[model samples]
Target chain A: MTLRELWFRLTYPLRQRRIARDLREEMSLHVELRAQELLSRGDVPDATDASLAARRQFGNATRIEGAARDAWGWHWLDGFRQDLRYVLRQLAHAPLFAVITMATIAVGIAVNAAAFTFYDAIVLKPLSVRDPGSVVRVVQDARITAPDVLPFSAYDALRKQARTLASVVVTTPPQAFATILPGRSPDEPSIAAARFVSADFAPALGVGAAIGRWFGPDEDAAAVIDYGFWTRSLNADPTVIGRRMIVGGRSLTIVGVAPEQFAECTSRKPSYPRNVPHSHPP
Target chain B: MSQQTLAAVEREPIPPGTLDMLILKTLARTGSEQLHGFEIAETIRERSRSVLQVEEGSLYPALQRMLVKGWIAGEWGHTPERRRARYYRITAAGKRQLERELESYKRVSAAVALIIQSA
Candidate 1:
């Protein structure tokens, strides 16, 4: 559309009221003139009869006014506004129906939103890990897709024959430990949650140490602190690696600080990781 | 004693789509003197010798459409009796439209006349 046409459409509403008023005024005047014409021509005996006859001959004044609005290209808009106002008045007269309708719509929207959220979180959004499409937790069928922990011998056998798959990781529930850090009071040891996992857990989940390397396979007493725990309890100490910390009255070496993103694999983030042998702890 | 009370409906309704032409022709013939809505309707009726009727509904909408199309311009003025009224004047475009419509109307009506008479 041309700029002038756009400008006219934009400004038309401002002129619409005056134009509509003028049309009404002109139509009424035409009726009055027709009535006077009838009276002057001796067609009717009285002014009242003449006026009524003139109006009848004029044919639906309200409809003519509406058609005039249509001629100016606002018929539908004016009609819709009038309809909407009428609907609002009717709705005001029946408040209960309005409330029930509004409530039904709200409940429908809430259900749809909640269902979509769950679908997105569980099905659409993938787990945040490197090559996550290639990784999946194996669920056993002892009780219909149960997450039963596998024995070390079964895990080892599967690991040997699964040449096409990445390394398998056996993760266990986190255990609470009364942890005492160096230079802190041993009496008021903080309760820290620590995860136990196979040595291959770090490489399998693509976890990298923020400070030191992952503890060696033989270092069974060493532990790796999570990034969040390192920052909250240890102030992100750079040289804290190789330091000995007391856990459950036993001293264990602080081997590494794992990156922050590693915490997303489980429901609750572990404060630190304690290495378990390839076999489950006796 | 209006049109309804008259015998046999003497005034025929003006043909559709010809209202604009009649309105424009009325304004064009008057030249400098701008006529109001009532005057235009009155002129058409008298010119047709009371044989043609203009419904106010069709008349006002046609005038409005012409105003929007730049064929006619309207201004609010007072009648001789000091009554407020809208006066309309034909524009150049309206004159051109009147000539076109008149030519077409003459052609069609002549064709109809020839057919009816021949038949």
Candidate 2:
């Protein structure tokens, strides 16, 4: 990245070679002195014999050289490869232990991967927004046995009074709803789960429609179809926007089409249409 | 007894992996005097009163490792007999490692001694 780092990387091998040469020379000198010591001590008479004896005492030269080179770093992968070979050799000797160890490791890895995927989907992954960290959920702690619910009055009060929140929108829990296209098969209506929200919901989530535009405050009876529903049911008609669709017996205009992966407020559910009315129960 | 068995019974070998620490200790004891591989082996053997004999096979490898670790520094020089040799002297890091190894060795050996005495 920098000139100094580039220089170091370029010159590293030369430095390593010098170190290796020095180590080999040092060991050679030691062996020579050892032979001389044997001669001086009268352990061996002939010069060649003493030198041979000293070489024998010094053990395998190639193995020691390999070990000395390993100490200079950059051989970590080689060390790991050697360890793997050793493990495979041992596994060849004991097949059952190897199988059980492999099975255990496989199971451990599968479980860990599954848990990490679940965590990433639910908690680690942020909502698709301009700044997901700035998004906050406002919950009313009723301190009762029932689940926490924000009353409509309280929602309105928070929306009006809260200075810290950039925007406030109220959404109902998702429930099953059916779509009724005009003059479609009367016997078979397309069914889907739907969520109702206030006018500020889409803006607060900080997502724009893939086609057309989000429903504004005046468009109370408008709906935005999800990308999947638009493609699968409407055959991805380009002029689907401004088309009229009856949802729950109420004729509503399709104002926009949400992105394919944009599951409103959650990842697990399919990307279904969201209706933003002027006044909605919290 | 066979000659090999007799030799094995004659003197105990220095324990494995402690050769580096012992070499550092020897260099520290000699202070400024740098020791060649042979002298280091001899000093270790003598200091242990000949009870511990450092095999030439292990000594060279240990020295090579210590050199790479930068615990000890080596340079080509002449021995007392005017023989060319690579003399090694302990660095500051080597002295610190020697102190740590000595402390741990003392504690472990003491614990072993206590257990043996109780048994």
Candidate maximizing DockQ: 1
Model 1 chain B weakest 10-residue run by lDDT: B1-10
Worst 10 residues of 1 chain A by lDDT: A261-270
Best by lDDT: 1
What DockQ would candidate 1 receive versus the native complex? 0.44
Q: For model 1, what is the alpha-carbon lDDT of residue B119? A: 89
TM-score for chain A, prediction 1: 0.61
CAPRI classification of candidate 2: incorrect
Give model 2's DockQ, 2 decimals. Answer: 0.21
Clashes of each: 0, 0
- Model 2 agreement with the true structure over A25-45: per-residue lDDT tens digits: 767877888788777877787
What's the lDDT for residue A220 in model 2?
A: 68
A112 Cα displacement, candidate 2 (Å): 4.0
Tell me what TM-score chain B of candidate 2 gets against the true chain B: 0.89
**What's the residue-level lDDT of A240 in candidate 2?**
73
| C-alpha positional error of residue A190 in candidate 1 after TM-score superposition, expressed in Å | 16
Q: What is each candidate's fraction of native interface contacts (fnat)?
A: 0.76, 0.38
Model 1 residue pairs with clashes = none
